[model samples]
Target chain A: MSDAALRSPLHAEHVALGATLVPFAGWEMPVRYTGDIAEHTAVRTAAGLFDLSHMGEISVRGDGAAAFLDHALVGRMSAVGLWGAKYTMMCTPEGGVIDDLIVYRRDWDHFIIVANAANKDTVIAELGARLAGFDAALEDVSAEIALIAVQGPRAEEIVARMCVRGDDDIHAMRYYTAANILLTGDIHAFAARTGYTGEDGFELFVAADQAAAVWELALAEGAGDGLVPCGLSARDSLRLEAGMPLYGQELTRDTTPFDAGLGRIVAFGTAANPRGAFVGRDALLRAKAAGPARVLVGLVGDGRRAARTGYAVTDDAGTQVGTVTSGAPSPTLGRPIAMAYVPPALSAPGTVVGIDVRGRREDMTVVALPFYSRAS
Target chain B: MATVPEELAYSAEHEWVSGDTDAGVVVTVGITEHAAEALGDIVYVEAPRVGDTVVAGEVCGELESTKAVSELYSPVSGVVTAVNEALERAPEAINADAYGDGWIFKVELSESATDLLDAEAYAASVA
Candidate 1:
């Protein structure tokens, strides 16, 4: 395909900044600006701006939006208060994950689901097929909306400086909540405090045309605070350090949320907040009752030879037990770290495992998720 | 654009050969500037050590970056005479100055090497 076919709204800006453009999730996105380790460290120490316009945005409107989502998704969407966001998943009837999504309640009967870039079409198709008999309409607004994230330690301060209205509301905006806020130069945006980097950050949802404007504005406003325009490479390492799962890697079509230790997002009806039948509820319940066959855990390697995706995770007996989903030299930890699914028996925090790092046995210790966590 | 020095012999694999190419002459070897820029921030590198024999156009070591790990290929077949020990703690030197402090190893050629590309030809091949 041509480069124009997948260019984001901020494509020009990235090019001007000398970003390394690469094909990712069908979009020609910047893999890095300046350098990987440098940008990753900037995000950890200060702030980093990311153009996430490639992510898919699907909207559900009409009175049955809440009910439709409850039936279509694994989590109880009806329980999400207005303007509140819930991290959830949509699964096939067989309990396999279709895509992990964030459902943001816009009104009493409207919601916006942000799906991963590559999974957007699949998610939209699934949501549409499951929308029968509900008073709702589904639309893919990924082209109309642009998603940009400012994430890091100084993210809040930088984002707070751009508010034209509701500055206090921006500051007081609770995590996982969304609101229509006015920004510098009279730009209107639906902003959220949600981020994948495990930092204090804000994700701005704006019109596609205004994306570059907001991006440039943020870069200029955040220049003093040491915010740099980061690319996908830094974003990947940051998310890995945060112990979040990337859809294609950790959460695939064959992997269940329960297997990834994200069963909490899979809601079963409780007496206090009773939920109706949802897709994959029965299959997920079966998965829950049977327990996870494999568990996802963090692995911290001793040497610089980092484990990579598709590398075999081995037992002490040299048996191939599992596969690494994501691995890298973490900029925060200053060591090699990885996330892999291993047998439940060996998933303890201190259990020793072996990763075949390019035919070499590199020993790693199993640790809890999120190898690095920031102060709240 | 990354610089491809005209004085050095180039290999299609992007390694540069320096010094005398005569048989039994210890020639210096390092990755070209273009290769270093493409690899991003190199965190670790494993170059063939002294006494290890490496073959031309064959895998000899590894150059690991945060993004990916690439296999390093020897530009000339020979016995490794010396390896850059400074890279053990400072792999970023390769990215910072690919043709200088980044020279990975020195190989005493088993025989005079043949079929190496000139700077112009090597640049065109990559382009």
Candidate 2:
């Protein structure tokens, strides 16, 4: 490993478990423990534990926090109920996405913004600059915090077994809601029913020093339930299968929320309870009026030749229409699935399109977003 | 650590060639276990057509893992005599057993390649 590579608090644990560590977004994180396929299948079938300490967290709080976030983020932050989390985006003045983040309304005045690891510094700087007129205070709490996630059908069962304190009725907790939970030894942690794997999972935010204990406890409790320690590779395939857009891949500075079919995040013209004003509101409103030229869609087909990132998307006649952003062989679906941006006409489900896999164009049928969704 | 058989001659590109060079060298070519392990899971394997002439250290086909795609380079100049047809339907065989059942193709070596690495040297390079 490079000397400058940042190590997660659970780095030693990953090494002890014989994990394959890879440099990801400047952090020396585990990419796989046993293998990608096994770990991916474990999450889908049973349970999987993840060391996501590398992901960035920023705490924003003050009297003007709600008003400040509304103007800064694309979503209506003030509208989110207390202890609720909402998927939102922060965009530039021209409406180009700066980063896609989840805002957790912790209280009446405090909120926590979770950004992608790679975009942490950028998001912090952007938030600092945007806090000029507002009285909100922003703090980058990434290094001080460690995130551990337990995802799958057995997630709640395993998590409940390890909890020595806090919210006894955690099984009844609603999705997108967070509660502070204490584990054995009075380990203070915040548990949220949120995850990236498109499963019923919980993300636990704990102190950096307590990461290993939480990880080991979850793994020990989940051992009989077939909970395996998963890595970024499996997490990626899981998210891709769920049709979630990655920060650097599907969302970029050149791509707007509307272009990515995420215009619902932009708060505009909702007179019922309008979010007074926000950055990029005018541009987003204009984009809404003119409709996006291209939109994101899900593509599925047989065969192992996956249409990887940057692969060209073409019509049946071989004319280029768009490009693929993320793709992989779906472990659950037993075929190759991908997400791409294509013309609105070709974005409809069942529309046949050709994916230029290398030089050869392979036939793929456009499908609805989210190749797999767990039963509610 | 991935296994590197002593009976096979290795290449810098992580290809293992198994055959004798005394007579007309008939060699079976496959990617090393190290390459397969690094690739995570093999989802696609593109093999050269039978009877296709390939140059030493040149690209012959490609291997697609679940994460990324990599070019497969021929170790020595030869004509591909046989290609592994079974890999088309089951590419994960390479990840399961990279050397034995996963041999990519068979080649009739035209001439002895001087740049071929022995097992010790090849292992050292990867190590």
Candidate 3:
């Protein structure tokens, strides 16, 4: 890590835990505490706490908040229920993705949008330019806030114990719903049943100064349940196993949601009930109608060698078909898995393909989207 | 704080060579504990062919970890005598016991190389 790199609020805690720090998106963040595989297994079996403070948080408020967001994002913001969170994306007019974000509706006219750390400035600038005459106010609250997550099978029991509020119960909180929680010593925080890992979890949004306190408190409360402090490396592998698309990897400015096999995220207008009034509506509709030329697919390799990002995906004839976006040896599955973008004709399950790993065309079979999912 | 065996000859690329430097020299090669720790979990080890010849400081194979792939470089010029076939099914043995059971291969030296560093020198170089 460089001297001038941005540090997380829990930087001290990570250093105390002997974490290996690395530079990610201009921020010096913990990549692992003990090791990547160990932390990943902890999340899958027990629980793991993650410091996601580097993510961006932007607030939108005013009477036109919902309307403004409807025009700003691809998902229908007007349909977001109170205290409901929705996964959506901001796109260019040409249907190219700008960033995928999650919006939490605090009230009818107030909402908070959490975005990726690397694209924080891009999202702020693009939204600022598009809010010329909008009645909503956009405030970047990234620096003032910190995001922490407790994820696993024991997540609910652990996070439910952290909320000191007698009136609010975390057990009653539905998935993707947010609530205000009062912790010990009157530390107020916003808790949501949301996480990147494909497990039951809760994300706590707290003040920057109170982040370390909350982190220690959560870890202590969940210690007996096997909650370990994880880092970005484990988080990446866990999300990849869940079949989630990363911002710069699976998504980019040149690709539309349809190209990533996420066309359902886009709200195209219908004659009977028109709701497509946002950017990229036309281009996305055209892409949807014509069907995406290429689609994202999951690939399972025959051996232990993982096909990492930027590896070339070739057909049986050895012709270049697409490129790998993300991949790793799944700690749970005991096999190498990856996600790549290939033509729709070759995206179906059982399609034979080859991944060019280290100049060798390793055999890979196209599988389903998610390689692992916790039983509900 | 990785374990660095004092009796081993170390290469700048983090491989440790162990054997008697006799008239007809043969040495067993494996990645150091420090290198294994830095590489995260070892998932695969690509070994050189038994009859293949490798030169010092040349890439002969690769070690695939959970995080990324690292090149395996030869510490001295030699012809491969044997490869660790056990690693094909259980690569995690490198993470658990990188020095003993995780030995990657053995090479019969054509001309003994004298540029390899001792344990202390290798530790200092890494530090």
Best by DockQ: 1
Instruction: Please give, for residues A324-357, the per-residue lDDT of candidate 2 as tens digits.
Output: 9998878888789999999999988999889998
Which candidate order results from sorting by lDDT in descending order?
Answer: 1, 3, 2
DockQ of candidate 3?
0.72
**How much RMSD separates candidate 2 from the native structure?**
1.6
Tens-digit per-residue lDDT, A20-56, candidate 1 = 8888988999998899988888888899999999999
Q: What are the runs in model 3 whose C-alpha is more than 4 Å off?
A: A166-168, B19-23
| Candidate 3: CAPRI quality band | medium
TM-score of each: 0.98, 0.96, 0.96
Candidate 2 lDDT for residue A100: 96
| DockQ, all models | 0.78, 0.65, 0.72
Judging by lDDT against the true structure, name the best candidate: 1
Give the B-chain TM-score of model 3. Answer: 0.95
lDDT of 3 at A38: 87
Among incorrect, acceptable, medium and high, the docking class of model 1 is medium
Q: Please list the residue runs of candidate 1 whose C-alpha ends up more than 4 Å from where it truly belongs after superposition.
A: A1-4
- After TM-score superposition, the amount by which residue A119's alpha carbon in candidate 1 deviates from its true location, in angstroms, is 0.5
Candidate 1 residue-wise lDDT at A142: 98
Query: Candidate 2, residue A84: CA error in Å?
Result: 0.8
User: B1-127, model 2: which lDDT tens digit per residue?
Assistant: 8899998889999999887743357889999999998888887898899999987899999998767788899998888999989999888889888898899998888888778899999999999
Tens-place lDDT digits, model 3, residues A41-81: 99999999999999999999999988888998999988989
Q: On a 0 to 100 scale, what is the lDDT of residue A172 in model 2?
A: 76
